[model samples]
Target chain A: MAVSDEQARDELGERLRKFVGRPAAVAGAGKDPVNAPMIRHWCEALGDTHPAYTGPDAIAPPTMLQVWTMGGLSGHPGRTGAYEELLGLLDAAGCTAVVATDCEQEYPRPLRPGDEVTFDTVIEEVSGRKTTRLGTGYFITTRTEVRVAGEPAGVHRFRVLKYAPAPHRPHEPRQQRRGPELHEPRRHQEPESRRRQEPAPSKPLRPRPVINRDNAGFWQGVAERRLLIQRCTACGTLRHPWLPGCNACGGLGWDTVEASGEGTVYSYVVVHHPPAPGFDPPYAVALVELAEGVRMVGNVVGVPYDEVRIGLPVRAGFRRVDEELTLPVFQALSSVTAVER
Target chain B: MRAGERLEPLEIPVTRTLIVAGAIASRDYQDVHHDPELARRKGAPDVFMNILTTNGLVGRYVTDHFGPKAVLRKVAIRLGAPNYPGDTMVLTGTVEEVDGDTAVVRVVGANGLGDHVTGTVTVTVPGANPEATP
Candidate 1:
């Protein structure tokens, strides 16, 4: 964990230069689609089940508060998310670019289940610094706006220090806010109009499969339930998402296949960091092996936050992620099946 | 394309006949959906498919009817029953409403027995970005 002062400063400067002034906005305005159990898991992990967030009225999760602040850059696939594509850009530039060495949060809004939120974020500041262990790192300041459909949710500020000695966790600051969820469905416009007028300029026409009626079914399935994999009968191999042909056997003909929900954990990471949308911090994310023998990517849910492991078995359940898609997800096995290795 | 004019119907045939083929789906991972015993412990009356893994089925259904030009903007649904291994369910959608640059539709999934979920879907077209004026 020991490194030079100048080394850290230069690293921070490089990442800041890449994200400081850019903006990202999602096209086709709508809600991020809230799931009730996700909110419950979030609350259980972070230990913040405010009545407003879980009440029958249902409000959006606070982390989902970050929907739209990433202005004008949705056009570029690399810029769809404020920080995600930036990491790729940094990686391409030859920087290891690990995320925040440390962070702190202050909640301005208490979310109720089912409430829609619109968000926008900005790099509040960026600077270089040396850590206690002589590790040099860069710090970034981010601000996010949380809103409901067209209303207000909360505002959050995050500090990210990257490429340096890991910092210690700080005590969480407690705050208060309230609301209700059990209401008649209200019309929503999650993607603020600004997204349409603000696509970050990028080169057009990079050849990729065009999604028309023939392929609309694939995208439509994602909005519902069922994970569709391309099966190559020629070699008995499974393929990735939206593949035109089988990569395994060079099979000219292939068919779509579905998975049985049960699976095993391949690997897992406990998110002790800031919570992501519809997710609370301290949740477990695992690469589960589906019963089909095909390893798949998905989130593990409905278990104690403190007891997740590498080989813990799990099963699949689902929730409405939005109006069009039902998320295929997993829950931990109970009793002895739930016992960790 | 005219408003509410559905070019085709999106259908996904969900069957457990699929063979496992990667690091994603493994052996100990087998439960009733793959290994019935494991499925029971996971709080299910039976083994089912992970919702995310099955996303491609619904996506293919929409693309089959609409052509590759459609960009799926949003999807929302609730789980009605378990999708088991070998059993098949059909996922379907029909364009319900279209305003200016957007089309509102309802998508449903059905198994051999009957309907699973009947929900609404909204998609944005070339110029349907704006819903109203401030």
Candidate 2:
């Protein structure tokens, strides 16, 4: 039995490798032009203020490179069948789940306004089966060469992992006791009595915040109920949403300051649709501008969702929603302390 | 990880519009990317960016620094943090190894919260000095 299993795996690996150089997507010219409106929309979405993206001499934000080639809602027609066949083969092997692993891009030049974009993508590599925290899977990487007016301008390499969800490990009792953190919120929305009778299916954890050497301090602050902002020690420029370097002075040295927990809602939105596992619907999320002049995003609780608005005074507080999580939230100040600033 | 082979930092603004627009452009209709309330309901503080957008930004970061002549051969990135609106993600990379025409680069993108992306990108910089590649 073991020999047959190994043989089957080896056969599949050989098949997947055959697709390495096959065209995954061939985009047509100006399928979506690199235009000012789209660029403006992109800039507005990203809150990027670099002057290079604006005005008559504006260059498309190099990050917007792939946006120009995106097939949008309709998708592109040049996608060949080989990519799908490989996926189908994986699916047949019970590796039906998929997640994007990573991607890399290379630019030969900057994309400018009025530059028409096109590209042909090739399946670059497929890795041997491997195990990850998520599950057992194979990584598939693709390379796309982007062009302007048929000239090579950039290359985009994307990768994804197709895997089978690992069988429930009996040792992982913690996972079996409750659904993933993402689905935890839905349990709250449901009545406690109902939850006791019918257990929901297990859900994966909510997408955890990315933690690495640069911003681990901030997450540690979140755990401590202290909102720590990165301050450039050299320039004294306080920045939020923690950054590695100071935008004002390009300084890399930094320290942290605990926010006073005081701020006003700079902007907000109320979400109602698309039911998710952990969150209750129609909650208000705000861009709370701290007194320190930096902005942070969090849920505004302790007040009706409809009441959240621009300039509402709020105080930072911690919400311990799950056993493993404690997030910083904003509570509207009482009418007495609430002054429109 | 060569001392002299460093990529100039690139700044990417993370705005609500960006989180939503990137989702729309990539045809990712997941509510956590566009609907703030739903994202919160799903246990996120706000609408977080999708991987596709992050992937695109990484591509941009590399190409922007390597000039138009750099050809990305492979990009392998892993998500580290949730990039919510109101943060600026800074991307930095360093060439780790160079072999003939191809050079390997290690990159990390950090935001106010934490490292948003950490990965390795491989590229073939045609005509790049042997010292830069080898």
Q: Which is the leading candidate under lDDT?
A: 2
Across B1-134, the per-residue lDDT of candidate 2 in tens digits comes to 24359898988888887888878755466565787875544334568788877876776676667665665566667775568788888899998887776778888888765677888777666777656533
Residues A173-212, model 2: lDDT tens digits: 4334342211111222111232344354654444557889
Candidate 1 CAPRI category: incorrect
For residue A154, give model 1's deviation from the true position in Å.
1.7
Error of 2 at A117 (Å): 1.5
Q: Which ten residues in a row have the lowest lDDT in candidate 1 chain A?
A: A174-183
Native-structure RMSD, model 1: 27.0
lDDT (Cα, 0-100) at A122 in candidate 1: 61
TM-score of structure candidate 1: 0.28
lDDT of 1 by residue, A198-314 (tens): 454432321232557445555455433446665777887875554555777677677777665667888887888774544546667778877776776666664555667778777
- Where does model 1 exceed 4 Å of error? A1-15, A24-32, A46-55, A58-110, A129-134, A164-341, B1-134
Question: How many backbone clashes does every candidate have?
Answer: 88, 21
> Which predicted model would earn the best TM-score?
2
